[model samples]
Target: MLYGAAYYHEYQPYERLEQDIDLMKEMNLTVVRLGESTWYSWEPEDGVFKLDWMDRVIDAMHAADIKVIFGTPTYAIPPWMAKKHPEVMAQHHSGTYVPYGYRQNMNHAHPAFRYYAERVIRKLISHYASHPAIIGYQIDNETSSGQLHNPDVFQKFLWYLKDKYKTVDNLNEVWGLTYWSHRINEWDELWKPDGNSTPGYDLDWRRFQSQLVTDLLDWEAQIVREYARPDQFITQCFVGAYSRPEANVFDISKSLDIVAINPYHVTQSGLELDPQNDTDTIGPEWMTSRQDHVGVSQIFLNGDWARGAKEQNFLITELNANSIGGSSTNYPGYEGQLRQAVYTFISKGANMVAYWHWHTLHYGFETYWGGVLGHSLEKGRIGREFEQIGAELIAHSDILTDLSTQADVGFLYHEDSKYALSYMPALSQPGTGNPDPLTYERVFDNFYRMYFNVNAQTAIVHPEQEFEKYPLLVVPALYAADDALLERLVAYAKNGGHLLLTFRSGYGDEFARARWAVAPGILRDAVGASYQEYSNLMKEVLVKGEGLDLPEGAAATAWADGLELESAEALATYQHPHFGQFPAIVTKVVGKGRVTYCGTLPNMPLGEALAAWTMNKAGIDPVIEGLPTTVRVTSTTATSGERLLFFTNWSWTPQTLPAIPGGGKDLLANVSISESDTLELGAWDVKIIVQAK
Candidate 1:
């Protein structure tokens, strides 16, 4: 609802803060984030503190009437702590212990690590919890980018296994160590798993490691909760998904008040995958600029999906401040792209928006196009743009804060499945593994893309919940299934609820063991499909939409079941240029419920058709059109018992929309009307429209 930016105090000299604060106040900024890269600046010495300066900063923010969300300063351990307690060091993927060089360098699992971090957080939260200036507490900045290929994480895995299974005998049995010659008799004999002998080699262990990180995050959150006010929200910013280990990080982190994510949508220059490559030419198709935007949105969607399970609003904590890095060659998003990125979040129903930063590092503010506010006023064009959006948000605070919405579509974003898949090394490897890593990523991506294509209102729900809340449940290419989930979904379908599940959804147990009934498991009756060996479409399969004569291209392939149907049809078929027609997309009706299964991840347009088809079957309808791509609209009611709608335009471009037929006037520009023409949306725009009655 309000505009906010990550505030780094270490480098923000008094003069810079003055300029930034003045500019922010002029733009109607409501919140300011302090602490992130300021870890070292805050904790200069161990058992020593430096709030004399932070006090002044907080007082200044309060005087400006800006709400503050202070971040705990232990994200990056100070040099003093790292030097004194070497155990706090984070181990990277290649088995290298990284020194305290970058931010977020502390080992979350270390005992001494938690001790110091907890100490620092307790002091910081207690100081600011009651302060009139502080609105909330953000624990850390972008808690991602770990060298997961580490011995410390591996050792943590061993400890977790011992705690869960209670014995090495049990651990060995679950991992099939008897076949791999990787059996362990004594817990002490366990060394961190490598790419081969170690559980790190398995996808399940990777999942366990993700859980381990989540556990650490929980510990951090609990420590802060001990001192903070009960009403004040708590959140930790998470980076977009980069790997399987990071796939479910936010799902676990969603226990916080709001899930925060940083999205650096891609630009023409490309990404920083290789620290060495500095060429102008793009490297690979995956390494291109557009893919970067897709990847950013993908990660954001994953985080929001995880947050959906909490049934609470999520926030985009950090976005492109021109560039988040100090590189002179950083990718800069155009105002339009930034607008689109924000709109995507708004359309998806995010609660708040915050940019990466306020002031750029004059020393590190390299100008390939990254700094929001350069040292001088003349170069602060981006900052001015931010102010325009922020002022608009401030003008419409009530609708921004009080609005919430519910959707009819539920995506299968299971934390249990994501975690289990992460730790299974067999699944981490490609082909012939129980939770194949590539397969997991693709399966998740395909489902997300399809959901986004139609701006489908979605929530993340477990298979065990009452599906009556959701008219349609779309579970894509899942490789495992649990009996509890199977039974609940079965009941949901039979109860006249619409259930749209896909192939490979029900195949295995919680431990990645094959389920007894096979092929869509217990869902075979509801979907009219039974276990049959699936044939991967050799060539691209075409999914023909209703009326639109185009085929959507999807990746991971499979085909099963031609059920006896009262009302159903095969919408798509698999065909090689040489090999002929095999059914690809199939649908069937059971009870009052309908299930549609796609054998592959169809292209975006085709995926939209599938979603539209499901929507039609469920009787769901979209509210309005002609809104900016960045603006998301959700409806709720006020305490007065009036209908309220929240519209957030997450873009830099101006947008225009038609007035509501009756209710409240458009709150942003203060325009009053009874169904006027289009409403304008400036970049990073938000509007609240209430039912006037």
Candidate 2:
């Protein structure tokens, strides 16, 4: 793996450029990302450019044998550009222009923003394209963070709708605008989609926003291609893959040569746990482990989503280097935590790992967001841990690079479903006193986490993608889907695929309208299940797994479908006095395969049991059996048929397990391990076993 960090030499408080280079070399940082957030430094005045300082930094990095991924400084606009062209600033939904103090505050659709962004990007790529030290270019830093929501963007959105719907009447009818007297009589009558009650309009508006960001990135990438060498790639560090409002990651990734992401985890005390819950009384150590599990699950989810965006191994452009300091309380990562984080991404198909920064700026908004070195510029605990990680990565780069995840399970995710369900949640959990509505994305993440916790190698699969490669497919909260996808699922199941679908799948069409047919819409026949009545679970409903072994008090939450079986057999039934006979989970044989429908949100124990059951039905085996729940295992196979097993312990408590089958060499430890021996993992430890071809 390529080990590196984002570096800002211009922001260095002292004259330690050479010293820092030596430190980076000592730590085995092979690459340094530069010039991303320095638009003002690059062009101090309008139409004037300065490149001397950046050149010096690049030369110094090259001298240390470190390559570079140069970034286009378009994410942050220069003060001069903002002052000269106030129209470039994005207007908020409240009809106010954003202030120029922050990065990503400009409207990408504005002509002024586009002109200057293109000029700066072209200039930077032209100047550095031939540099031997330059390996690639990062196009903008986290695009679409501040999405444009002004009159200009609104007009463009209207045009986009016109192109999509062709006529105003069609747009109005499709969005069901007549319900709220929101029908647009003329094209000009359509207004910005603020406070829009129509689901179709609101969902399409988000899609348009995603398109805007994708178009902006495509424009810059095309310009870069004109100047960059064939070996030089272009990528953008995507943030908020699952929950971002402005852009869809899958759409944006289509325009890049390689996918990249900036993923961060909350530190201790940062887990979104209900404070009044009993989890707080578990004591600090256990509580810390619980929170770390949550954080690590998010990292793994994001890494898998990044890889799924392009179906290729991606780079970790920015990862947590230190405790993030903003409005939140930040906790320093415990020792061995950094190494665990790095391996978490690597095991999931991350080709490169880069820390957010080389050094924490002495004076900035993120000054307390520590880096490899602190304000003293001396190596700290995290830095020392990173050094060890870097050395190991260097030692095993060849084997790691060719490694690709071998997963037999896939989790289907769709951005359109996420967008549609945001306005109208598919399931509603009550009695929690939390008024916030549950999102489909969160529900999907919960299911994904269940499989992940059990060390099941899983991939995020889009509905449009070729999902047949995985024998087992788990789809959760697919609130909005098209007929094609519904038919595809049925075909997949009929062809010997084991399909597991949770509550709210196929409830609505792509237009966000309820299906005219039976509940579950087009999937009723495929799943052999239909539900006409369902209710939110104000309290947990106990469910008894009839044939499958499950823990006591296994229950369903959020929502439960009053399912009436057509041709399916009940696998689990409700234990409630009034609903005792109703099936909570059912399965149906379709031709050579089977489909399982879960009527409600299965709690963790039930979810894990269901995952195990489904995997067995699909004839998929775990990478390593009997490993601790805290230890995550993922296996990858190289082109030469060499297999690699990555075991990451996500907890603070050390875990011991029997050596995995076919154990050959522990690449990280450089020691041979046999299947008969035992393997021990320290707190937040990682172990890699590579079996010869």
Candidate 3:
């Protein structure tokens, strides 16, 4: 379940490590990370530290028995520790502290940058913790480049808000800062929370920068568990909602052992960096410039940035086989974007399938070259279609490892109302002076873009818990419910649970202010619907409706726009160019839950056919149905009982799918099956089915 790659330090070419070990023994490639920017290819000297060229690349990948993972080469901090400690550098919270460049730039609360990153991870874990081709340690690479705004992390967020509000008048009453007169007297007259970008000082400085970049990857998983072997696995790299404060900025699942993700899924049909070149970085109209999707709608910011940091079995550790380099689009290269972003992260439950940079660099790091097999693999190579999808992920190895699947839809996601709606910036777009931030960041980007192109799977319950394991309880934009999460959403819709909410959701109360009334105001009698007037209307209109299948003049508009939803059985209306009509959608049944309220922001094909009619009235199962939207199906069952299934053919041409109703076998085309099989794949294909008892 840990198929790996990443290595890259001038693409090893020792006459092509025996053709990359015969193309990783035809894709059964167990593990091989070895990347810490290859520590300038083994100490380009300065108080030098070498360990004989990483013990001859871990004795040529343990004489091709491959296992090794090791990384912590102090994430490129070896310009002799920033030319001898330039205050350990890094800075940037808008103070722009660049001591040097590229590769993360240490200073994680400096103690001489954690003593040269724990002496380059205790010299690469005591020189390969007794090699046999080492088996763990990935600590740093894509560590913290944004989350945890600096001033050396606001002087350790003023001693962690004076040891979690024990003094400074309980951090001036939980940062209400005595309303404008602002008071602190002295925890050294604290500062942090800036840009009155309102909403309770931009949601406690975005929950203090999402718990300061997940406590800097929980202090690098407590220094890689004092140097590895707690059953050696340790993970770190994460991305998905790639931090505007939170989706993931280091939650190393309570200090590692496993939870690495790096998805870069980019497929909004045809591209040229569509959504009008949405630049924030990574891909598809990038985001994270302290986010503000104006009002949300870039297909709910690209399926909530690829279901931000996936969870289930958790472990992508970098997915995206190709076509990036400062995009001009050209399109789906590295085998059609690694067969649809690794079949949308192993059909959403990935066990482990690393990618990112297996070479490709020609002219000095070409601005983040989305790798696969370039530099060598030589002779007019087009990456033999990613070595034939890595020889079909090594023939679907044991149904794609550890599998576990279950999700009827939960979507509560409130990390303090996503940190007061990701720094309000006056909800950016009116000269960005910052104001509009009431954020649910487009309801956590439409529950991670309908759990990856409607294969449907969501979990994050928290509206004061107990919703009876999801019957469908989406509180998207639950702007801080309280009253015990609106009496646990009115006892999970009177013990029936199938609610849906939207619009500045319940109008804030947990101290972000505003709740005088309006908005599900105590969920308007558990969404029997009451809100009389709400038409903040700024126009970007288009609402179309008429028995939903949509696409024949199917438009729903208002990207960063807002509010609408009147009532009296009007599923949708308002086709405004300038506030002509209103009411976006409304439904009610209340007790035994079945409310619906969405006033705006529903366009990605009518918010994926209203999230496939609220996941077909909460029966749930969109994970992939009716093929092509770029195939993907993540379902798992391992711990030995075994029942794995992960088909991801992200599309570049070549698919077929639809058959796994039962009889299985494709474990990477080792082939066999029943329920009338029908796969095909190719382009960026990847399959792993097991099923049959």
Number of the top-ranking candidate, with TM-score as the measure: 2
Residue 399 local lDDT, model 2: 79
Clashes of 3: 29
Q: Give the TM-score of candidate 1.
A: 0.81
Task: Compute the lDDT of residue 54 as modeled in candidate 1.
Answer: 82
Give the range where candidate 3 is weakest over 10 consecutive residues by summed lDDT.
294-303
Clashes of 1: 37
C-alpha RMSD values across all candidates: 5.8, 3.1, 19.3
Q: Report clash pairs, candidate 2.
A: none
Best of the candidates, lDDT: 2
Global CA lDDT of candidate 1, please? 0.60
Per-residue lDDT of candidate 3, residues 445-486 (tens digit): 644565545666555544334446788877766665566776
lDDT of 1 at 656: 72
TM-score of each: 0.81, 0.95, 0.37
- lDDT of candidate 1 at residue 476, scale 0 to 100: 59
